[model samples]
Target: MQDCHILITRPEPENTLSCERIVTHGWTAVPLPMLDIAPIEDAQQRAAIRSQIFDIDTFQYVIFVSKNAARLAADWLDTCWPMLPVGVHWIGIGQGTTQALLEAGIPAISNPGHTTEALLEWLKPAKMKDQKILIIRGLGGRPELGDKLEERGAKVHYLSLYERKKPHYTAQTFFMLPDIHLIWVTSGEGLHHLSEYATQHKPEWKTLPILTPSSRVNQQAKEMGWIHASCADGADDNSLIKATEFHIGKQHD
Candidate 1:
């Protein structure tokens, strides 16, 4: 295990944590952040976010799509709302997001699973007619959540608090790809970037095992001609570590 190297492609702060966890498990962790998270700093957008934070109680449900969404929304809510209003349900899409919300003092936050589809299934049985749901996330994501909520007779609002941009990698970065034993792609965008980089600069590395957090990314990797693409149960750190270990064990077998 100590001889194994796992390439982590998550963004900073998160990448640091993931790398530390891998090291704790007696594996070498190499960080190459594929996406950079930037906050929305436009005056108009900030004003709109402030308005939503002030009127947080109006929405019956507040949904956080990722850990980034939970952290950014919690920052605004902590600033604008002296105290979180009671009776409003908080929904986190996964364990990581749920833990972030809980740490922000949001009580009783619910997380159905790691994927949006799972969350939708868990929410389908709830009464949504005339209910208002606010979704906080990065800019330009899937519309399925809002669309499904609308179909259930719920009004949906979005607070695009951050943007995810592909990071510029130098030639040295791609040179290290051939040495990486395993790659971990947490998001679809990360997988796309990795595929693009590998195709352009390190095509031989495409055969290396890739562990993803979702089926969507796994499919994308396979379509890109990656021979070994495996998916974990969720995006949480524990799931990712287990998946990485399993893939490494299989490689030895």
Candidate 2:
């Protein structure tokens, strides 16, 4: 069987697991990271964490918006609180985030699908009126969740634990991409990173086929002149693999 290659543009955890799943299903995975998430640059954020560590008990719910957020928050929790606070519920924004928290020893977690809308839907059942919710997330994310929580009478505290910045596309990311048969883009930001790189350095991608995770990303790809483009349902590895298989199979047929 001829090996197939698929490009991954998501951050870690998702990137890592997506590679594992695609390879397990007998495909070659190429990771050209579009974003690098690191700790928030603000010193005051760290200082606030230190100052509020002991008050973990005051929060009725602690929500992690991504695996990156979950990992950073868990590390900070170990250094700050050290012990798990009683009656504090944990909410993970996606399946991957929930698994990350569970692996980190947080047993009580509410995991919705990977969007603010899904998180809100999951929270609807809990009906946490007047509860204090602390959201540990990355910098400059969508504020819809927090705003809705506040509107629903929940006291919301949003903390930025990390920041997502575009990673430099090394020669490896560009030179090695020609052999890649498929590209799996999870978000518009990830696609924007690729488009920006192509615009500055490699103009060949204007003709390339792209497999995006949503119609939004597909539209973005089309706007960027990617004539051959398709969309998966989401960033989930399974969904990505299915998309790849469908495209590859169609080409073969």
Every model's TM-score: 0.95, 0.84
Cα displacement (Å) at residue 145, model 2: 1.4
For residue 80, model 2's alpha carbon misses the true position, in angstroms, by 2.3
* Candidate 2: worst-modelled 10 consecutive residues by lDDT: 107-116
Residue 153 C-alpha lDDT in model 2: 86
What TM-score should be assigned to candidate 2?
Answer: 0.84
Give the Cα lDDT of each candidate: 0.86, 0.78
**Predicted candidate 1 versus true structure: per-residue lDDT over 195-252, tens digit per residue:** 8887888887788888888887788889988898889968778999888777768767
Best by lDDT: 1
Candidate 2 structure quality by residue, lDDT tens digits, 17-117: 78888888888888778888888666877888766656767998988877888888888888877678889898887666787899988865654455567
lDDT: worst 10-residue window of model 1: 104-113
- Model 2 segments more than 4 A misplaced: 41-43, 170-173, 202-209, 214-229
